[model samples]
Target: MPGKSGEIIDYIKNDLERDPQDIKTIVVTHHHFDHTGILDKLKKITGAKVAIHSADADYISGEKTQHGSLFMIPIVMFMKIIYRSRPVKADILLEDGDQIGDYRVIHTPGHTSGSICLYNPINKVLFVGDNLMYSNDKIEGPRVVHEPENYKKSIEKLRNLDMGVILTGHEQPITSGANNRLDTFLTELYD
Candidate 1:
């Protein structure tokens, strides 16, 4: 973090009274530029280990360009113009069932090849990163997916979990009744 962006560092020091070094790991949910744009810079400042799913590690490592639909080309380019992507290697390659802190990694691929959801069984909170959306009292799937079949399976996988809270990558979080919201969404999705 440099220039105006260093405010994150400043906030940590001034508000939280904590050092950037306190950060131990940077967990990335996918390869989207919006999620990983400043990852390289942040990693440098905090000296944190970068963790990303193995399927998407190459994109973060700059070994391969992000794969997406043709419609996303323009959106991706726009992201590049607004926020430059700085590739950084992942220190830990994660997979399904891996535990990061108190969260269990659920590989819900579809939105991206390595899209994931972090489930905390203790709190019954699920962190669905772009694999699902919650807004206007509704739970919806991603608008676009790289693999439609995988997306359906991912939704099915979520159905088996006992989720009370849903923290989404975008839109407001579903703070309660997460299971019911997901059920309604699934019904609508299938219909």
Candidate 2:
């Protein structure tokens, strides 16, 4: 969520330019700083209900601390300083198959205990938060350090989806044959 707050605000208010009153909810896929950089401010400006998976609700609420590996401590500290994720309570606690509007929440925990992906079956669009990533013409697990077993299980769970396109939390979108790519990643992962 760490970026120029003004740019994000302008993008939401001017680029998309939707009425603030019309924007109802801000969905967070995980508690990571990169994805939540401007969350606090964005919610303030849009007055949207903040939704997150229950497993990570405590992290954002400042009720629990995020513990990472020794090597990642400094990096996490730096991100905390840079992003300043202001603690906020979650308005909605999502679980697997929970529907919010057109999207269905998939609890894909690995990169974090509460990592999630939103799948819109009607549109065949999957909003996959860092559960997976695209790199070097290949779909792979999260680039960041994560819980390996949980990540694998999460991928296996997602492999069932008949997705047309995949929009990851970061980087380029997979616009064609996303399910195939996921299959390949799964096969490679299990092999």
Q: Give the TM-score of candidate 2.
A: 0.91
Runs of candidate 1 exceeding 4 Å displacement: 1-7, 14-16, 69-84
lDDT of 2 at 180: 89
lDDT of 2 by residue, 116-169 (tens): 999999999999888888877779787774677688888788888889889987
Error of 1 at 125 (Å): 1.8
The candidate maximizing lDDT is 1
TM-score of each: 0.88, 0.91
Candidate 1 positional error at 113, Å: 0.8
> Candidate 2: how large is its RMSD?
1.7
- Residue 87, candidate 2: alpha-carbon lDDT: 74
- Report lDDT (CA) for all predictions: 0.85, 0.84
